[model samples]
Target: MIIRKAIKEDVPSIVSMIADDKLGALRENYQNPLPLRYYEAFKRINEDPNQELVVITNAKEDVIGTLQLSFIQYLTYQGGIRAQIEAVRVHKTYRSKGIGQKLFEWAINRAMERKAHGVQLTTDKKRPEALNFYEKLGFKASHEGMKLHL
Candidate 1:
């Protein structure tokens, strides 16, 4: 398997993976000829130097997993930069096959390479298995994460 920066054409596959689960089904608007908004968001992310949207592909180059890493500069931690990982998903068929672990390993290493002081990610409380998987990768529930939806 190979992990690489996602291109525009990979949007649909990525969205499919994102929408495969119960929670994602409620929030993601994935459909045939997928909504224009996904592509628009991809363009914005792709253009940002601090954002990375990556896809993990199999030997045939089929997209099987994806994640987005955003580097944030902050005044805390001695003006350090932290990498925030989001939207991680592996195709249903690819789960339990070590793909997700590989994805995280790559992202964490990339964050270090980019000089990030730490890497962080938030998994929905509803996803206990996901939380467990993250814990295995050495992440801690260091702080309570809250969100305000507009």
Candidate 2:
């Protein structure tokens, strides 16, 4: 398997992975197949040197996993940057195979390379396994995250 930056063509695979049943209510919002704007946002991310999109591909070179890392520069941190991880998803067939860890490890290294104060992310309350995984990765629930349906 190869881990690399995501390209425009990978969007469909990314959308499929995230739309999997395992995603639960989170997918309820972005329920449709990926919209074109996603690639547009990806283009913006690609243009930003401080942001990154990572994907894991199988031997067949099919995009099967993806994650996002966005850098936040803060004044309180005093030159220490922050990285927020988002949209981590692996193909259904590839679940429980350490792909998630590999993706997160890549994000961590990228955050460190960017001199981030820390990396952060939020998973839904329904994703108990993911919460456990993040805890194992040394992340704590520092604040309560909420959302309002529009």
Candidate 3:
């Protein structure tokens, strides 16, 4: 599989992957005509120098996996820069083929190249399998994550 920066044309496939799971089905809009919000968000991400929207393609060049990485600069950790991985998803047909592992590896390497202090990601607490998958990749459950929906 080839990993590369996602182009605007890949947005629809990425959104479909995001809406493929049960949890995602509940939160993602998968209407017959997808919402414009997705395209708008893609525009913002594409314009951000610190953000990357990536896709994994097979030999046929079909996009089967995706994730977004954001490099953050903060005062803590001695003003270190860190890469945050988010929106990671692989097409259901492509799961269990080590694509996710390869994706994470790519992200980690990219982070190192950017001089990031570390790479971090959060999986839904309900996804025990995902939690285990992350642990195998050397991530630790070092802190509690909280959020407030607007």
lDDT of 3 at 42: 93
lDDT for model 2, on a 0 to 1 scale?
0.84
lDDT of 3 at 82: 91
Which candidate comes out best when scored by TM-score?
Answer: 1
**lDDT per residue as tens, model 1, 1-150:** 999999999999999999999999999999999999999999999999999999999999999999999999999999999999999999998899999999999999999999999999998999999999999999999999999989
Q: List the candidates' TM-scores in order.
A: 0.98, 0.86, 0.96
What digit string (tens of lDDT, one per residue) describes model 3 on residues 66-137?
A: 999999999998999999999999988989999999999999999999999999998898889999999999
**RMSD of candidate 2 to true structure, Å:** 2.5
What is the lDDT for 99 in model 3? 98
The order of the candidates by lDDT, greatest first, is 1, 3, 2
**How close to the true structure is residue 30 of candidate 1, measured as C-alpha lDDT?**
91
Show where candidate 1 strays beyond 4 Å. Answer: none
TM-score of 1: 0.98
Model 2 TM-score, 2 decimals: 0.86
Candidate 1, RMSD to the unseen true structure: 0.6
Clashing pairs in 3: none
Best lDDT among the predictions, by candidate number: 1
